[model samples]
Structure formats: C-alpha cells, structure tokens
Target: MTILVMGATGAQGGAVARRLVAEGHSVRGFGRSGEVPAGVEPVTGPLEAALDGVSHVSLVLPMLLERAEVDRWVEIVAGSGVRRVVFNTANRIPPAATDVALFESRRAASDALLASGVPTVVLRPPVYLDNLRAPWVAGRLAAERVLSYPLPADLPVAWISHDDLAAATVAALTRDGLEDDVLDIGGPASLTGPQLAAAFGATYEAQDVAAFQEGLTHAFGPEVASVVAATYHWLAKHGGDLYETDPTAAERLGIRFTPVHEWIAA
Candidate 1:
C-alpha cells in the first residue's frame, strides 16, 4: 500500500517512512523542504493527485499545531481512498484541562481530526528519549558527564523513542478497526531524572526552570526560548506522569517498546 506521509523529512515522519519502507510498502512524502528518506517518493503536486490510490497518511504538524491546517489536510484526504490516518500529537496526555496555549492548540488539532470525517488513529507520544540527542542537552552530558534538563528531579516520565513511535505508527497505518482510537505511545517504563541520567552513565543535574530558559536562549534564540520555556516551566511546576505503558495496546498494535536503558545502550 502507498502511504502519503506529511512532514516526511522530519525526525518523526522520516522514522515512520523508513519503517514502512523497510516493511515493503510504498511511501510518498508531502513536505516542503529537505529530502525524504532514501526509498520514499516525494510528492510535488496537489493533495488530490497525491491521494490517488494512497492507502494511508501520517501527519507531523508543527509545534503550533494549527487547527485550520489540520481541518484542511483531513478535508482533502477524507474521500480520497486513503484508508487511514496516523497523527502524532507529540504529547502523551493531550486535551488536558488547562488554559495553556500549547495544550489549547494541540486540543484543537485533535478535535479537528475527529471532526474531519477521516478514519484517524491519534498517537500522543510523551517526552522522547531522543531529546537527549539534542546538542544543548548532549553537550552537558558529554562535557561534564551530567544530564541537565528542565524537568523536575522527582518527576517520573515515560520516555519513548522516535523509533518506537514509528513502529506503533506503522502498525496503525497497515491495520484496521482503529478509526477514532487515541493511544499514548510511552516507553517500557517511567523513569525519574536521575534514573534517566544513570542510563547514560552520567550524573543528573536538575536545572532550574529559569536556568533552563537561559540555556535554551543560548542554544536557540530568544523567540524559540520564550516559546519553549513556558512548557518547561509548566512541566517543572505541574507536569506529572500523564501516560504509562499500555502493554495491551502495544501487544494489539504489534509493537515492542524500547526501554531507556536499551536505547541508551544501542
């Protein structure tokens, strides 16, 4: 089956496309920049043409998670013979009862999918272990053997990898009877900051929310830092273990999640 993958050049979308291709499926990408993974075809025309004989679609929206774009994409793919949609909300427990702008945007995106008349399966993945690969985060680990990030020390987070997310997404794309389902794509288990650091053979250094903002400012620019700092502050203050391992979902989806230690070792 041919799969139309939006954001196919991105980290998550690229991972999904590679997994699907490795499973012997045709993959097409609908992205503006960057190259799609080696075996995937890059779509360069209208959505109507792109959807011709397409079996499924995987969307990776921007951080803003605009609702209008969500509605627009779904509207085009609704009757285009696309059998399914696998949307990554980049959040584990979305639509939380909150006035936060990020949550509001993600909630709107999720609502748009449900209302768009498409057979959609939403995967809300929590904090990715891949975040450890970020330059700013990794630099600390490499230089001082310290894992420094914004999340509170006591917080237990279900850290997942983009690879695990890709596996789950591929299962969703090829399978059926998951029309309006929402799955929390978490890791094998939850880990605290120190526990996560211990996997890297590093010492855990919890950063102050303010210090995190400063570090982000130094790594990225002010505009990016301001937008990111809000979420970090929220996590440091109130973020809890919003999602846990759903073993039944994993078994049903035919996904074997990677644990933190396993990923670290690899």
Candidate 2:
C-alpha cells in the first residue's frame, strides 16, 4: 500500500512516516518543505497534488486553523481516490465545549474526514508527555526548580507519549477492519497536576502553577495562553476523561502504550 503522510515535518507525522518506512512500506511524506526521514519519498505540493497515487493518508494538520481548510483537504483526498485515512484529532473536544476554537477545529476536521466517503480512523490522544518540555516546564525547572501549569492541583490527566500516538496512527493506517473508528489513546497511568509536579520534583524543583503559566505566556505568547487556559478549564470542569484510553487499539496493535515517566526519562 502506498501511504501519504501530511504534516510529515511535525512530531506525529514524522514519527508515523518513519515507522512506516521501517516496516518496508512505500511511504510518501507531504509537507511544506518536503523534509522527511531518509528512505521515504518526499512530495512537495499542496494537499491536492499530494493525493495522487496515494492509497492511504495520515493527517496531522494543525489544530488551531479554520475548519474549512480541513474540509477542503478531505474533499481533495477523497476525490483523488484515497481509500483510507487516519486522523490525529483532539480528545478534549466534547460536544458541550464546542465553543473552544482548537477543539472545534479538530472536531470539524474529523467530521470532514468521516463524511468524505473514505474509510477513516480517528485517534484522539491526550496531553502529550513532551508538552512538559515546553518553556513552561523548562523555565520552571531552571529557576524555581518546579514544573507547573494551569489546572486544579488534583485534576488527573492521561498524558500520552507522542511516540505512542504515532504507533497507534501507524496501526490504524496498516490494520484492516478499523474504518470509521474513533480511538482515545493515552498512557498506562494517569496523574494529577500535583502528582505530576511531585514526580518532576523527584528530578527537579516543584513550582506553582501560576508561575508556570506566566512563564508560558511569556514564552509562547497570549494566544497560547488562551488555549492553555481553555484546556485547563475543560479539564477542571469536565475532567480528564476526554483523553481516557480504551486499550482496544493498543491490544489490537500488540504494542504496549508507553508510560508518562518512562517517556519523560527517555
């Protein structure tokens, strides 16, 4: 099967493309610069041109954009005879909180993909473990010796590793009989904000959530701050079940999901 991976320069797409190549499949990476791992074909063009000769596609587009772009991409891919797709969607976008732009955008994309007459599987991964490496945690670890972010201290989040998300995406792309499925993939263990802070304290100092957010705003700007705040509000009000794992996909793929700390250590 020939697979075309969108956003191949980004984390999830990059990992998925690499894994597919390692498995000896014909993989083509589509992105702005066509920067892909060695041994993979790089296609530089818009989504329409990239859809040619592609039997399957893995979409990892940005989550904060206008929904129309996603719809258009899906239309192009479907029109081009792409039969299967694996969408990296956001788990936090519940029907009740459709007002959040990021979540709404991802939800729109998922809907578009499903309605595009193509077999599709959507993987909704939770907060990534690598998100901790953002300047919010890095600065906190450097100065205050702590890791903090907005959210109730006791709110538990099922943070999945990006590597695991990639693995799940690969499984969805390569496996059969999983079309039109939506799977929430997360880590084996869930940790509360305070619990995660304590875990970080084992290796670095523990800082307050306010300080972390403040540093994050400085590092990432106000738009990111608003998104983070909205995400924390969703977690606090609706809880972390948004990103909860079902284990079916992992079991079917025969790959154990990586734990949060284990990924962090790596």
Candidate 3:
C-alpha cells in the first residue's frame, strides 16, 4: 500500500510514517520543507500533486489552519481514490468545551473529513508522556529533578506516547472495518503530577498561570501567550484527564502499550 502523511516532520506524523515503513508500505512525507525520515519519499508540492496516486493519506494538523484549506484537502482526497485517511488530534476535549477555539478547530476538521465521503478514522490522543522530555521541562527534570507545568499537583491525566498513538493509527490505516470511526486512543493508566514525578525521579512544582504566560509571552509574543495560558488555566480549573486511558480502540486493534513509567524510561 502507498500512503501520504502530512505534518510528517512532527512527532505524531513522523511516528505514523515510520510505522508504515516498518510494515513495508510505501510512504511519502509531506511537510513545508524537504525534511523527512529515512526510507520515505519527500513531497513538497501542491496538494493535488501530493495526493497523486496516493492510496491513503494520514495527517496531524501542525497548527490552526484556515478551514477553507482543510476543506480543499478533503475535496481532493474524496476524488483521488484514496482508500483511508487518519486524522489525529493532539488532545481531545469534552463536548461542552466546543466554545473554545482549540476544540472548535478540531471539531471542524473532523466534520470536514467525515463529510468528504472518503473513508476516514479520527484519532484523539490525550496528553503525551513524552511531553516531559520537552526542553523547558526536560532540562529541569534532569538537573533539578522537578516536573514543572501549569497544572494542579493532584489532577489525574491519561498520558499517552507517540509510539502508542502511531500503533493505533496504523491499525486503523491497515485493518478493515474501522471506516468513519472516531477513536480516543489514550495511555495505559491515569496519573497525577506527583505520581508523574515519581516515575521521572523528580518532584512536582506548580507553574502558575501568571508565570507561565509571562515566560511564553516573552518567548512567543502575546497572542501565543494568551492562547496557551488559557489552555493551561482551563486545565487548572478542570484538571487534565489526559492520563485517563480509553480502552475501546486498543481492544479493537488487539494492541497494548507499556505503562507510563516503562514508556518514559524507554
């Protein structure tokens, strides 16, 4: 089988592309530049050209793109003879949070893909355990042994990893009988800040909204700060169940994942 993976340079898309390659499927990595992993073709052309002869298309939106652009992608994929499209969201929010732009963007993207009449599988992965390895947190985790973030010290989250999300996406892409399915692919278990720190051999520290926003504003400007701060603030109010693993997809795919500690250590 042949596949085109958008956002292929990112963690999620990168994982998907790599997994497909391991399965011996032809893979194309589509991103803004020519960069891509080994053993995959790189395509940096018009959407139509990228979709050429592609059997399947996988995507993880890099950022908030115009709805019209995504619509066009859907239109092209619908007529391109593509067998399946897997769209993965970084996180999934409750329906009540639709008013928020982040959640609305995902809902809008999902709607377009499903309406395109092309077989599609939407994957909603919660907070990733690999986030702890980010520079802002990883350095501190290594040097000071403290896990810092703008989250409550007690909020439980179902943290997943890139590997787990990719496995599920590949299953949906290769297996039969999963067309038009929206799956919440979470981690093996739910965990809190203190509990998360225990796995990392670190202590937990609260990164207040004020401090978090201030740092982000200085680094990325006010728009990003406001938007990101709002998300963390929202999570602070309503704790992140990112670590709440949903078993529906895993059960269907006949797959299982390592626990939070084991995944992190690996």
Candidate 4:
C-alpha cells in the first residue's frame, strides 16, 4: 500500500513525507521541484506514473493555482482509483464565502474532492507556527524582540505546527471510518497575539494589514501575497473565530498537538 504525497518538497508536505517514512510506509513523493525526503522516492515524470500502485494519497494543492486549474487537478485525482485521500485545504474555511480568493478556492477544491465520492478527509489548518520563521516575522522578533502580526490583539488562534499537522494528516490517511470527514486541526492551546508573543518572550505588536501584505508580497510573489493578505483583511473585520471549536476533535482523532513553547524551542 504505497502512499503518494503531493508537494513533498514543501514544509507541510515534507513533514508528512518524513513522518510516513519514519513509520516505515512506502512513500512516493511528488512535487514540482522534484525533491523528497531521504527515505522517500521522488517522482519527476507525469503524475499518473507516480500514482501507479498507490493505495492512498496526500493532496496539497498550491495556493496560487487558478480555479479552473484547480478543478482540472481535482478531476484527475478523483478519477484516479486511489482508496482514500487526506487533503490539506491549507486554510480554515470561512462560515460564508468572502472576498478572500484563497478561502474560496480552497472551499471549491474541497467541495469537488468530496463530491468525487473518493472517501476523502479534509484537514483545515489555521495559521502555521512554522510561519514565525518567515523572514518578515522572524526578523522583527530577532532584531527588535517584537512579535508583529496583522491579526487582532484579542483574536484567539490555535496556531498549529507543521509536525503536528503532519501527524494529523497521517492519522487521516491511515485510520479507518473517517471517510468524507472534515477536521480543523490546531495546536494544544488557543492564544491571542499578546499571549503568543509572551510564549516567545517577546513583545506583541499589531501590524497594519497593508504592511503585512507588503511583506508577504516580497516573500511570495504579488499574486499569492494578495490572496493571502485578503484573508487577513477579512479576519480583521471578522474577529474572535480562528481557534478550534471542536473540543473533542483532538482526542477523537488521536492527535496530540504540540505546544508553542515546545515548537519554538525546537
């Protein structure tokens, strides 16, 4: 039962690939960059060739893909005879459609996958703890000892780490009786901006959405940055809702999320 992992070169997917390999699973890694973890095999040719002999798949779609292109890829994955799929939506689904292209596109892709009757599980992860390592956030924290973010000061977020996310993805893929289920995975604690900064022993500073957007634009081209920034803009308007509300989800899924201090120290 070989598992095919998409975007294995990326942080999230790389973590998953490594964990799966550590567990002694047969892993076939697929990424545009043609890179995979040491134990995993990389696929440099067509996706179908990589899909061969695969029983399950870990799908991680890129954020910059257009709706039509996303639809095309979803169609292909749905047609593939894979037994199950663990799809990382990469963002929390909004209560209703908003102007944020990323959320809408993810929702669309998730709906298509579920509608495909592929016995899929969708994982909606909030802000990644690993994102703190990004130059914009890390630079400020290191040089000025301030943790700056565009989120509201009081808004609580269950920030998740890539390792925790990888563990959740593994459970979603290997566990049974989870077909067609949607999960919102998060860290052990839900923290506000001040609380999160305190964990890092740094001061919390609320950054303007425009400035945050500008920083993102510099990191990941303008198009991807715009959509990501739009999500924060929406969050600024809609506060007090990013944390995980499902109290029993972690215990039920057998996932133990890592703490902020542990993540930061690592």
lDDT of each: 0.79, 0.73, 0.79, 0.86
Show where candidate 1 strays beyond 4 Å. Answer: 44-49, 64-67, 79-81
**lDDT by residue for model 4 over 79-173, one digit each (tens)?**
89999989999878887777777888888889999999898999998899888888889999999889999888888888998898899999999
Q: Which should have the higher TM-score, number 3 or number 4?
A: 4
Instruction: Point out the worst 10-residue segment of candidate 2 by lDDT.
Output: 202-211
Q: What are the per-residue Cα lDDT tens digits for candidate 1 across 1-266?
A: 78998878888888998998899988998776748999999986577887888888897776543557666766676657567888887775434566555666666666777777778888888788888889879998999999998888778888899899899899888776778888877887878889888889888877888887887789787866777777777777678666456666676677789888888888
Query: What's the CA error at residue 176 for candidate 2, in Å?
Result: 1.8
lDDT of 3 by residue, 1-266 (tens): 78998877777888888888888989999987768878889998687898888999887766546657766766776667798998886777565654456666777778878888889988887777777676888888889999997778888777788888888888988888899998878776777889888888889997888898998888789977776677677777765564367778788766886688888667
TM-score of each: 0.90, 0.86, 0.91, 0.95
Clashing pairs in 2: 145-205, 146-205, 146-207
Candidate 2 accuracy as TM-score: 0.86
Candidate 2: what lDDT? Answer: 0.73
For residues 1-266, could you state the per-residue lDDT of candidate 2 as single tens digits?
A: 89998878777788888888888889999877778988778998877777778899998776444567767776787677777888887454575635566777777778877887789898888778777777656676667756655555556577787778778888888787889987777777767766676666633333444565566578778767666666556565666456555667677665789876677567
lDDT for predicted candidate 3 compared with the true structure: 0.79
Clashing residue pairs found in predicted model 3: 157-242, 157-243, 158-242, 158-243, 158-244, 159-243
Compared with the true structure, the alpha-carbon lDDT of candidate 1 equals 0.79
Which pairs clash inside model 1? none
